[model samples]
Target: MAHDHQHNHLVQMLDLDAEVLEDFHRELVGWAGSLVGDRPRVVDLGAGTGTGTLALARHLPGAQLTAVDVDDEMLEHLRHRAADAGLQDRIRTVRADLDGDWPALGPADLVWASASMHHLADPARTLARIRDTLRPGGAFMITELDGFPRFLPDPGLEDRCAAEMDRLRREGGMHMHENWGARLTAAGFDLAGERTFELEIPAPLPPAARRYAQVTFARMRERLADRLSADDLAALDDAAATAAHRDDLTVRATRMVWVGRRPS
Candidate 1:
């Protein structure tokens, strides 16, 4: 039950990300579509909530997408979202752990991994596997976040929270900061393109953004319960409680994307 509850929060968070950052998502999907053929066979690694899968499907009507994730619950949620979007025909969900033996997902023309590669136990090996999964000259796109988005107007509290989160992630062995472009080259993929997006949505945020801020604060509060100082935890609690009602909130985030290609 606890796991399910956590998954629910994750689902809401991912979906809200797509919703609140609709422009960025659309631009990303368009850019990804530009790298492939009209009838490209795409694979979305760690496809949580089917955001990329469904977006790619809708953007490229002729594309076929396979959304793969280790969590059965995530896959189930993706399937349901695809069905709701009327993209079930073009999108299929596969449950497989990328850290272990990968299932046959290839000869794909394009493989997309968004904010998911950093979680792999061995990213280099996974990159090699992804190279093999794609056909010659096929493209692989990777997206990674610097950290969670910050919604506070004053940067002090959020900065402290981010530092604590970084410490926690580092101690927990997460690869949050990696030179992925160089890694792709070392993995024998030609670095095709790299871009970093800096997003800032100002005050008068939509209702969805407000809820997103609330959820993010709440999650941070829970995760940093023991890590943050007493005063910081209390501030987080107050922020989470009043986030939805705050008019001064702004969303700031940075995302980096790297594209690599299998040499023909």
Candidate 2:
């Protein structure tokens, strides 16, 4: 029951992210569409909630997509979303732990990994595998976040929260701040392009943004329950409780994307 609740919250958060940041998502999808050929075969690594899978399918009508993830629940949700979007014909879900032996997913035109590579045990090994999985001259795109977004107007509390989160992630062995471009080059991929997106949605955000703030605060509170001071914990509770109605909230985040290609 606890797992189900967590999964539901994650699903809602991902869906809200796409909705609240529609401009960025649309631009990213369009850029991806421009990189592939007609009827291209694409693979989405760690396709949570089918955000990228469905978007790529809609943007490239002729493309076939394989959405791969370890979690059965997430894959099931992706499949349902694909069907609902009338993209089931072009999209298929594969269940596999990316850190383990990967299943046969190869000879593809494009492979996309967004905010997912950091969770892998060995990203260099995974990058090499991805290179082998793609056809010669195929493209591999990786997108990673610097950290979680901040919605509060005052930077002090959010900064403290981010610092704590970073420490916890580091202790947990998450590669939250790796230089992926260097890793790709070292793993034998030809670095094709790199871009950083700095996004900021000012005060009086949409309803979805408010909910996003609430969910993010709640998740942070839960994760840092033990690490944070008592005062911080109380402040977090207040933030989560009031996030939905805050008028001064602003959404700020940074995402970096690196595109590499397998040498022909």
Candidate 3:
């Protein structure tokens, strides 16, 4: 289960000017090139709003995708996106929980998990299933945030927000750091490679990117409302208000990616 409304907002925020999504797919496909065959299938595990699905549609052209997620609204959004892009024939939505019984999807050439592994009830077990469902030599790529957003113009304020978010995560029993490669190895995957992407934009990002960053800060402000001190809260207000301004605005973020393959 997920906070549907919040998840949608989160998607809108991180999808920086749409370039961020392209960066993700570019890196993923770059790591494992067009592995297309007769009806190539790519599983978008825990696919939220089909961000990764749509990316694959463009880069991996001519491949079928199964977008699996428990959130129906998110899947609906994905469906519409696929339809708009004239990719509905190649993309199918499945409402299923990553923790529950696996859906009826057949083996895939590559499985893409973007910021969705943490939500699983049992990530390790689910990973093994992912491995088993992949064809020989299939690849699995997963991405997770190194930490919360650090794109504020002010580093000091961003640190304060990050520290508070870390505390909240701890209190909520959320798992933050997991050795994804090690888990994949245990799940019978041959470690392939991994990398960390630094998404940084200079001040005065495009109008869309600026609005994206502002939305991100607004969501963060809402989440830290009760926890931030009076001074910190005021600083956040200033940050949120100026997030969309072109003058002296900067954005920085890190996304960790782990790639593995099922043995041939």
TM-score against truth, every candidate: 0.97, 0.97, 0.90
Clashing pairs in model 3? Answer: none
Segments in model 3 whose C-alpha atoms lie over 4 Å from true places:
1-8, 34-38
* Stretches of candidate 2 exceeding 4 Å from the true structure: none
Q: Write the per-residue lDDT of candidate 3 for residues 51-100, one digit (tens) a residue.
A: 78888876777688999999887788889889999999889999997778
The lDDT of each candidate is: 0.91, 0.90, 0.77
Top-scoring candidate (lDDT): 1
**What is the Cα-based TM-score of model 2?**
0.97
List, residue by residue over 1-264, the lDDT tens digit for candidate 2: 766766777888888888888899899888888888998999999999988999999999999999999999889888888888888989989999998889999889999998999988888889989999999999998989988799987798888889998999888888988999999999999999999999999999888899999888887887788888999889988998998787999999899999999999
Error of 1 at 151 (Å): 0.7
Greater lDDT among 1 and 2 belongs to 1
Worst 10 residues of 3 by lDDT: 14-23
